[model samples]
Target: MNTVTPPKERAAAPETAPASRRSLLKRPRQLWAVTGPLVIFVVMLAIVAGLTPTFLGSNGLTFIAAAAAPILLLALGQALVLNIGSIDLSNAAIAVLGAILLAFLLAPLAAAAPLLVLLIVTLFGAVNGLLVAYAQVPSFALTLGTLGIFQAAALVLSGSTTVYVSANGEAISALYQSGILGIPMTFWIGVVLAIVLWAGLRFTRLGLAMTAIGNNESGAIFSAVRNRRVKVVVFALSGFTAGLASIAIIAQSGSASATGAGGDLLLPAITAAILGGTSISGGVANPINVIFGALTVALVPIATTAIGVDAQAQNLVYGLVIIVVVALTMARTRGAVVK
Candidate 1:
């Protein structure tokens, strides 16, 4: 007598079919996932270029690169902290504080800007790490508190006024304004940082472990991951990045003010991280996409001016664009889940 296949085997056969179908669908989804934002960026650029030929000029490009450097640096820091399911609101304040410190204390060591900046940033990072990791406070609360504290410290250091980078203007300028093989220094720095971080996340065990911790801290702990240590390291790295950003700002603007501690930066930095496909809920980060996100954010003002939009209106447009993109991404993500 011929025996039919068991029902369980029949079910397994259909499951395999669905899996193959899902894989086929995944390819297009992945393509759109990256291409959607890219397409928007190109459209925006083309519109701006059509409106104003100067939009593509060398001076305009330099201005965008220079302006984007500090924000890009800060976003990179935020991205790192975010990758591990944590937030760092203290970035702007930390940057201000670092700039003040550099102007007053480290400027004398002109020959050692790189080394001095590294040490100061390391210390700032360690402080953040200790408070967040060992103290067991939520990163949001911890960083928020530190934000105020650091801002106050910056004010005190600057005496509540802008501190000009006149003393070491040449050195600072060289750091931010000079070019390497014709590429702007600031642009090169951002590119290098992005590449290094991308490599780390792709090829390193620590990077995989950080993703695991971010995805599920409790589960990662059960699987023997050092969650606390990893979080601390991530926070420290964030601080370091903030410090680097501060140097860039000081170099480019030649001044630091308390007013600069909170304005036009917080939202965009977070937006860049999210828009780059780094999950707001953490667990995933794409450095390459983040670079594009940075470029997109940086281009907004240029585009607006080229198109003759008022500054206030441009701000509104930026806020609206961020909201729309985020909503779309969320909807697409949900659809994928349902499907």
Candidate 2:
């Protein structure tokens, strides 16, 4: 009989080897996403400590906490917008307008001024969200347009001048100057807010919807997610936080200015969010991690000074850090367009 013996079945080992290797490779990336910001913060702190021993003192640490507080709020807001697959270029501008409004309303509204400012900015953000959700406007363009409008409005409202909260400044002033357990009150507020946000994002239905929409809007829609409502809420939160940050700014400076309210904060806030492991392509964010990012940014100028670098070179260093971090964390897929 010429019947050949059946070919021995191929071993399953070769087939599973590549899959196992891929699983192993994915783990490091997952770990990196969680720990990268902390690593960077520690490295930066070490460098500063090595170069300038004075930076490890109580006063320096306190200053960093206070200075980073406002940026932390702004970055938290930016992180929300980015999570929803959108960008709010107007957040910084919103802060400026809120400061102007806060300055004008404090005497008349008293303690209610901050509350009113928060409401106004939240509504302002809702409008942006409405246009993006229902009107189908691209967020980048819409926010860019609103940025110009808000800036112009601020200039007109403040008459191109700084507004001082001379009479009723005490309430706002306490936010920055007061400390609890050796930390600034402003820092405590930021920390509390971050914890609340983190809890909401981790445990709520709204957070699930946000992640879904960011991951795949069409899929989210198919899955019965109320995409528009979620977006509106997300942007409203962004605006609310911006307003909160404006209060912090006024507290720190004891006054508000059209130029200084937002100032160079927009870029730094975006950088902080990104550095904190919030994916720029959306679908992920961590308010807790973002605190470390804010601290990293606040350390930039201090780090530069500690290392004897020129002050003007700070922006260059920021640009470099942003580029490197983005390159590493950006999501990539087949046929994905850069736009």
Candidate 3:
């Protein structure tokens, strides 16, 4: 046996142990992975609290919530899509079109405008899913192409202007205007949606399937995971969230402007998701954490003001911080697959 042994054969003889929940709980890296983002969130808030002193007061909190709501929803959608190892660049475009189309519908349909708008965006998501999952097109490329088309369509549809809602349009207009216990109604809606998103990703079989597919596509297919169907549904769900976010957007401004209104959110939402501890690679994500991620992102301008940093410097700082955190997290899971 000793005389016949070869180097290549010996190297292949050892099998790696499978990762287990018990081992995960024991690993400090697991602890850091779960706690790091939360720590960042608290630290950011603490800095803000110290700098402004009044920023945590009632009015300040309300202002932050109202501003962060749409971003939170967008981050929610982005997190979901990214969890499945995919990207969606069409969100901002969808939001723009959703708002414009809703405004156009409201003049005639009135109370039915919101429902109709949600349905339209949902269908658009399904189409996106089909193209990405069935056509074998890369999500990044497909979404980018769709992005240009939708943005152009929105502008052309609106004739390059902002859409406005009348005060008389109370039913639809109140979506952004009304509040409960002094909080924006949209904020409550966002909270509910966050819970739903979290539950879907963390508790459902479909969520697990998505995670499996993200973790190992070949293995998932071998294990009978409905990879295509799960991806389609993920895209559809992302679209549904985009629809909700679009409502919030229109509610805030009372119109969907054809001039790149929603487009700006895509990058920030993605940054928030990554910062929230959703892995850049496939296999790990937490939707609930993304809400706090939105909060941390929303705090950027505020943090800049608090620290006397220039607005222009904020993005650079945000990027550096997120990149470092992600790098460290990746290092922690370097040896074995994470899910």
Which structure among the candidates has the greatest lDDT? 2
Clashes of 1: 0
Backbone clashes in each candidate structure, one number apiece?
Answer: 0, 0, 0
RMSD of 1: 6.4
Can you write out model 3's per-residue Cα lDDT over 1-339, one digit (the tens) per residue? 002336874665564444345545787776766676677778877887888787777466677677777888888888888888899999878887898887778778877888899998988888899999899898999999998998888989989888776533566558667787666877678778878877887788998898887777788899999999988888887787788888888777777786745768888788778777776666778877777778777777666766777878887887776677556433234345454
lDDT for model 2, on a 0 to 1 scale? 0.83
Candidate 2 Cα outliers beyond 4 Å, as residue runs: 1-26, 326-339
Where does model 3 exceed 4 Å of error?
1-26, 180-182, 324-332, 335-339
When 1 and 3 are scored with lDDT, the better candidate is: 3
lDDT (CA) per prediction: 0.73, 0.83, 0.77
TM-score of each: 0.86, 0.88, 0.86
Q: Give lDDT tens digits, candidate 2, residues 240-337.
A: 99999989888888777888856668888998888887877788888888998888888877777778888888778767866876565444444655
TM-score: which candidate is best? 2
RMSD of each: 6.4, 7.8, 6.4
